[model samples]
Target: MGPSVAKLASHDRVWQSIRQSAAAMVAEEPILASLVHASVLNQLHFEDALNYILAQCLGTAEAPAILLHQSFDELTTAHPDVGAAARADLAAVCERDPACRSPLEALLFFKGYHAIQTYRLAHALLNKGRRPLALHLQNRMALTFGVDINPAARLGRGIMIDHGTGVVIGETAVVEDGVSILQGVTLGGTGKDEGDRHPKIRRGVMIGAGACILGNIEIGARAKIGAGSVVLQNIPPGCTAAGVPARIIGRCANTEPARDMDQGFDDVEA
Candidate 1:
């Protein structure tokens, strides 16, 4: 098949899966049939469904649902990569999170997935110098999803924020592709420091829940940060760091710590 036809087929497959899931949800819970139809079955495309869902979650008395929906639609249409990243995030969550059953589940119900997609749109707006609107969306995302990621934060695709509540990614933080961060993770800076602060999390890094990486430190690729550790310095590639002021404990056994989702520090030396 031609490239365009293949792309169309892929989209159709995703839409079909989502529709089937929505139909099953309606059959199982007759009371929520209207909600299912409005959020999923009534939509024409993936972006449209996303717009509807985000509007429902983020809309306020001041902003209103239709305005939020239009903004989301415009962002998805303007930057195709936002939609592509949303799909990749869904796949990442499905593969990484044990609770995720299907792409439809991640797309429809995962707050982490929802937060990241909203962040993508806010990031786009920030890049366009629409600071007020971007910050507004960022605030709404934090209020609705319990995840506060700055609009200026640079994040790559295939990110999984498992149990994303209380996750805070600072303005200058840079999260590369294939990074998995658990709840209460803070990629913040030393107090009152200006310019290019916050951590740079490289590819394939798995950060355990409640880990705090501070300053402008570089977390090298495939590194693992243990749960509740406070990272204050650069972590070398393939290393494991843990403790209050996290130290390089030992080497990581797996090359792809993010994909592996291994939080064990059993083999690491004290």
Candidate 2:
């Protein structure tokens, strides 16, 4: 007797959701709708399609994922040594996040994903002396994504921003390697004055949800900020700061989960 073959369930539900989401996104933000359509069509897997759709709901560039992948590949080919670590950092994050269906998912759904990719493109433009265009795109990204990150900000690799809504990274902000941040966290300026007015976020730091770290203050490496904290001063390394006027409350040797990280998404498991 021949063995029975299992029938694959219809993917109509998934496709329908994708189409509806794409249409809604277009209705909301027509300028980037076509890009979202392209991203949805490009995905080969159902999970990837879902991820991309969810990203649209959360606000992200549908085009940057593809472009950044290509750019990263080119970078790896051209300067293998310099690009290796950054690429590895990206890959490592993807590996750790099982929800990441593909490298493209990592690019689209990860907040740090968009930020890092944009930073690379912006940095390239900065190097090429195309500052205006870079800044223009950066602003566009801020408006489109609801996360204002200046292209000129110097950010190191493996940075993650959970939820990412209301996150503002200023022009003079300097974020070092392995930092993770949550939604409503601001690395911003005190005023409109020209000098350095942004915060310097050191390596391996984690900023909790709705935590506002203002001015040119320094957040030492491996520091952690608790949810809803308003930091107006410097935070030493290995400390966790919380509350309105943030104060050191605990110690963190690793990434601390913020409130935004615990926020739910509506999706059934495959």
Candidate 3:
């Protein structure tokens, strides 16, 4: 199928799956029937349902739900890639997260997924020079989801952020496609340096939980960073880095560490 048609079909499949899951949820838990209908069954498309849920979660007294919904809808319509990236993220979570049973679970329950989608909208606004609105959304996301990603950061598709709480990505951080970042990870600068201070995480890199990657370093594609490690230097492609002031331990066991989700380190130094 053509690219556009394929994307549409992918969205349709996800919407159908969500509807089926919502129906099953209503059948299993009668108490949640109304909630399921309002959240998923009543919505027309995937983006519509997403907008509704995000608005409900992130909207505040200053920016009400209806207004946030309208803004999100406009952004999604203006830039269709936001929806595409969201779908890819859903697929990534379903594939990588062991707790995720289906795309519906990621859509309805995963705060990480929700945070990324919200960031996508904020990033779009930032690109359009709507800095105030973008910053507003960023603040709301941090307040609501505990995930703080700067609106100016560049994130690619197929990203998986597991247990997204306390995850912070600084401004000018460039996370390439197919990167998997776990909880409590920081992609920040070492000091108060300005202009492209954050790290550039290449494609298919897996960063473990509680790991801190600071400064404007380039983490090569398919490299693995062990949990709780403090990364300070550039890591070459296909290698694994671990421990405080993370050093290159050995080659990555898998070519796509992000997809593998393997955090084990055999040759890590003390």
Candidate 4:
């Protein structure tokens, strides 16, 4: 009875799912799974949950998971020095959250983790010339997480998304280096045009929550987008945009505030 009790107590469905999924993942892409596993292990000591997420993306309800090792490896190889920045940013987030005890926990529990992972995987597919597959997965990630970023969307170093809900960065949305964005922001399209209908957010811009910058607008470098604003045109550098039909309201003093643009701070009110 004591042994049986211990066995039952040790059982965990979520962990079991992770293990099964990971083993199955070995078949699809052993090298890529190894690469992902290495990354996860380097950042997380016990990363079953993270593995579960990767598996979920690669798995089906009834079938074994497809690991896509080559795809994973290809994506990581595309950004050779990116892991350092990603780790640093993730560390910063963990420090800000009192509940986060380690980078491992942050990697496992944070929505940013999920969003970035989806983006990374999708980006890998995009790089592989799998446009339809990449776009399809990107859309699926958006529907699942409420944060939509295209794999083809060029994101530079130190990009952060805070409280990442309802954030839509359209196809061809070019976000340069050191940009931060809050939640509920849409760098979206204007109409049914086939190409180049989205905004181009330049480097070091801080976009606030619930702000909608529409059409083929170009938001200049270091510009600030205030919460809940709707912009239909271009915004110059060192400016702030606010209100419905968002307009230039103020000057941007600092690009880095309490929360980085990517930290989802824009969702504070909404």
For model 2, residues 1-270, the per-residue Cα lDDT tens digits are: 012211111244433444445556667878976676666545543334433433343333644545444443444355443343345445545544556555544544565555555555566666667787567557656765667788778877666665567888888899887777767888888778788889998877767678788899999877777778889999887676777798766665344322123322111111
Error of 2 at 191 (Å): 1.7
User: Lowest summed lDDT over 10 consecutive residues: which window, candidate 2?
Assistant: 1-10
lDDT by residue for model 3 over 15-134, one digit each (tens)? 877787888988989998877888887777799889999999988888898999999999999999999999999999999999999888888889999999999999999999999989
TM-score of every model? 0.94, 0.63, 0.94, 0.68
User: In candidate 3, residue 199 scores what lDDT?
Assistant: 95
In terms of lDDT, the poorest run of 10 residues in model 1 is: 1-10
- Which candidate gets the maximum lDDT versus the true structure? 3
Worst ten in a row by lDDT for model 4:
40-49
Residue 100 C-alpha lDDT in model 2: 57
Model 3 lDDT, residue 32, Cα: 88
CA lDDT of each candidate?
A: 0.90, 0.61, 0.91, 0.63
Name the regions of candidate 1 deviating beyond 4 angstroms: 1-11, 267-270
Q: In model 4, which regions exceed 4 Å deviation?
A: 1-53, 62-70, 77-85, 88-102, 255-270
What residue runs in model 3 are displaced by over 4 Å at the alpha carbon? 1-11, 267-270
lDDT of 4 by residue, 130-194 (tens): 88867766776776677888888767655666677988888788887667677798888878887
